[model samples]
Target: MHIQLLGGFRLDCGPGPVHVVPGARRLLALLALRDSPVPRRVAAALLWPDTTERRAGACLRSSLWRLVKPETPLIVVTEDALVLGAEVDVDFRRACAFAAAPGASPEAVTMLKADLLPGWWQPWVEAERDWWHQARLRALEVLSDRFRVSGDRHHAYQAALAAVQTDPLRESAHRTLVELHLADGNPAQAVRQYQSYRTRLRAELGLEPSSHIHELVRPLLR
Candidate 1:
């Protein structure tokens, strides 16, 4: 089973196009919380907290059934819990884990292609989306550290470049690019990034770049 959490939620199974439904995304988020088995009642509360218990239970049941197909079991319900079926793989979780680990792997970097569920707007969606953002950034930092240690200047440049693309506003992204360029003996590129950051900060916030940043790039001015 293929599960998508990058935009609203979508689940795909064998021999059929992906299914889209309301509430399925919530169910997927509950299941994505690692090995923790979400209690039936808790899932009900999160998805329909303001509703009556009876109504919430009914909604959960309906959402679960929507994934049913003769050929695939997308979800499994036990005596009192719910989980993504054994056949299903949760990519966000995998991506988060890989990104957090010590070494950089292709799979880990690929996992952070976009922010989590760019299309969803529910409160719960925001919570998970924030989580993935912070997690992905942390992974990029780890990759940068690994590359710097190994003297992999090219990969280091590439990783920092990708990180900034993911979060252009993050001062750390600009900072990382600056450091990577300096280490790669490209101080001119570092100065260019600094100037870009200066313009962005002035335009967006009407403030100057931090003194620390100004200090770092001072020697590189050509």
Candidate 2:
């Protein structure tokens, strides 16, 4: 069984995709992401914080029951804890591992392109989503640098633009894009990019671009 948590939550069993309720999906996602046996009480409380303890526990049990079947068990439920089945493969883990490395292959970059469970507003999902978002941003930046060093100017530019689009306020991403333009023998474009970043930063945060950014474009200005 393979589970896709990036972009959206999907469970693919051998025959086809498994259809599950939203609560069951959340439960499965939480268990898969935790990647370890979570205490029953803790899982219940986190999954249903607004409910009474008894109600939360009941909800957890019901979700677990719906997720399990004699032929295809998605979760391992013990008296004290719950965990994803051993056979499940999660794509997010693979992307995270690849992102931690300095350079990434095109395939790895594609895998990192997805946002984690976009539009899911669960409180527990927020931290994990933020973690993947930052990881992917860093991966894109690293990939851009690697492409630049390898003389793949077009790909480098695309990667840099991707990083900028992902987080406009990230000065490092803007710097990468600026450097890409400079490397391509387009000082005019570099200056334009820097000016755009400066304008956006001032309008959004009432702040100037950092000295590092100014220094990067200083030589071109002269």
Candidate 3:
């Protein structure tokens, strides 16, 4: 299965265009929130809090039925359990697992293509979006630390650049860029990064860069 959790949630069965309904997506998200198999009643309450028990039960049944048809390969649900079907493969879950581990593979760090569901602007998606965003940032932070610890300043610099591209407003990224440049004997580049950050922060927030930011690259300004 070609499962994509990056942008909203999409699951393709092999090369076919199988559709996963909204309820299924909701159910998947709920399941993903838990480490162990969540109880059926709890799942029902979370998704259908506004409805009566009977109606919510019906909706849950209907949603699962649609996903378990012969042609569907997205999920496997037994009497009291639900999970990603054995045939399905999800990159986001895998990437998240790798990112959470202490010694995650560099390949896993490289797989996070973009912020999760960047164009999606639904209130329902916010929680998941925040979770993935934090995970992605942590992965990059770990990668940067690994590079710096290993005496690979170039890779550390590149990781910092990638972090800035992901989140330009982050003063930490600019700090990393400045530190990396100055460490590599490129004080001019460090100054340029600081100037750009100062201008952007002032323009956007109508405020000066933080005192910590100023202190970070003060020597390079000389």
Candidate with more favorable, higher lDDT: 1 or 2: 2
User: Model 2, 2-55: lDDT tens per residue?
Assistant: 888988989888867888887789888898888679999999998899999999
lDDT (Cα atoms) of all candidates against the true structure: 0.73, 0.85, 0.70
What's the residue-level lDDT of 156 in candidate 1?
Answer: 63
Model 1, 159-220: lDDT tens digits are 66768777776777688788877776888888999999888888988888777777779866
Ranked by lDDT from best down, the candidates are: 2, 1, 3
Off by over 4 Å in 3: 68-74, 102-106, 119-125, 151-154, 203-216
User: Candidate 2, clashing residue pairs?
Assistant: none
RMSD of candidate 3 to the truth, in angstroms, is: 3.5
Candidate 3: C-alpha lDDT: 0.70
RMSD values, in order shown? 2.7, 2.1, 3.5
User: Which residue runs does candidate 2 get wrong by more than 4 Å?
Assistant: 68-72, 218-222
lDDT tens string, model 3, 36-98?
666677677777878897887788888887774556545666787666655556666777776
The TM-scores of all predictions, comma-separated, are 0.83, 0.89, 0.75
